[model samples]
Target: MEQKQPDVVDIFAVEERPGAVVFALAVCLGALVLLAQMDEQTKWLKGAALLVQPRFWPGLCLAGFAFFALCHFISTWTRHRKSRQYSFLPPDELANWARPTEYALYFMAYVFLVPQLGYLPTTLLALPALVFRLGYRSPSKLMASMLVGLCTVVVFKTLLQVRIPGGRWYEFLPDGLRNLLILYF
Candidate 1:
C-alpha cells in the first residue's frame, strides 16, 4: 500500500532570469524622470489644437511610458518577492553592466589627446596601444590596427575635409611641412 502525493502549486512563478528586475527598475525610474521633465522641456502654445500642440503628444507619450513602466516594476517586484530569488539588488549583474565604463573613459581620454597630439598621430598611437592592451601580441594585428587608424584619419581629414585642429607640437616643424600637416594630415 502507498500513500498519495500532493502536487505543488505556484501562482506567481516568474521566470528567473538575471537582470530582469534591475532592468525593469531602471526603465521605471527613467520614464518617471522624463515625465517629470515634460513640462520644462516642451512648450504649451496658446490657441493651438490638441492634436497639433507642441506639448500634447510628448506629454501623452511620456505619461503612457511612465504608467507602463510603473506597472512592469510593480509586477516584477511582487513576483520576485514571492519567489525569493533575489534580495535587495543583484550586485554581480550591476557590476557587469558597469564594466563598459572603462572603455568610455578610455574614449574620453583619446578625445582629450586629439587636440594636443593631432588627429593622425593620436589615432595611430591609440589604436595600436589599445590592441596591445587587449593582449594581441601578433605583429599583423598591430599593423592592421595602425592601417585602419591611418585610413580613418585620411578619410576624415583629407577626403571629407572635416576640420580637426592641428597638434600644438606642429609649431616646432618647418613652415611648409607644418602647413601641409595642418591642412591635409
Candidate 2:
C-alpha cells in the first residue's frame, strides 16, 4: 500500500491583497511626505519646548511605523513574486462586506456628528439606533439605552467634569441644571 501525502496551502502577498497592499504603501508614503513637508514654525510647535514640540513624538512614531510597513510591503511583494500559489481572496470580496462596511461608515458618521450635536444628544440618538441595528427591538431595551445615555451624561459632564463636545443644545436644559453643567463641564 502507498502512503498518501498531505496537501499544503500557501498564501502570496500579491495574490492575497491585489491592489490593497500597494494602495496602503502609497498612502503611507504620502502621509510621510506630507508630515516631512509640514512647516516647523507653526504656533503650536513654536510654543512647545525642545524635544517636546507638538509634532516631534507623533512624527517620529508615525515615521517609524511607516518605515516598518514599507519593509513589510517590499518583503511581501518579493515573496509573492517568487511564490507558486495562485489562489487568493480578491478585492471582489468587498461585495460580501456590505453590512460591516456600512457599519464602519455609520461609526465614522457618528464621530463627525458628536461634536455638532454635543455628547449627550449624540449618545442619546446613536445608542438606540445602534441597538436597533444590532437587532435589539424591545421597547425596554431602547428605553434602557436612553437611560444609560442620560447616566453617562451626568457622570461625565456633571460629576467627572469631562468637557464632552458642548453645543447650543445645552441651553435648552432648565436653568438650575444648565448652571450645574456650565459650572462642571
C-alpha TM-score for every candidate: 0.74, 0.52
Write down the TM-score for model 2. 0.52
- Using TM-score as the measure, the top candidate is 1
| Stretches of candidate 1 exceeding 4 Å from the true structure | 1-17, 45-52, 74-88
For every model in order, what is the number of clashing pairs? Answer: 0, 0
Cα displacement (Å) at residue 62, model 1: 1.0
What tens digits encode model 1's per-residue C-alpha lDDT throughout 1-185?
88655545445544766677778899999999998898899998888898899999889999999999999988887788888877557788788889989889989999999889888999999999999999999999999999999999999898998989998898899999999888877
- Candidate 2: where are CA atoms >4 Å away? 1-20, 27-69, 82-89, 92-118, 172-174, 181-185
RMSD of each: 8.0, 7.9
Which clashing pairs does model 2 show?
Answer: none
Query: How high is the CA lDDT of each candidate model?
Result: 0.88, 0.69
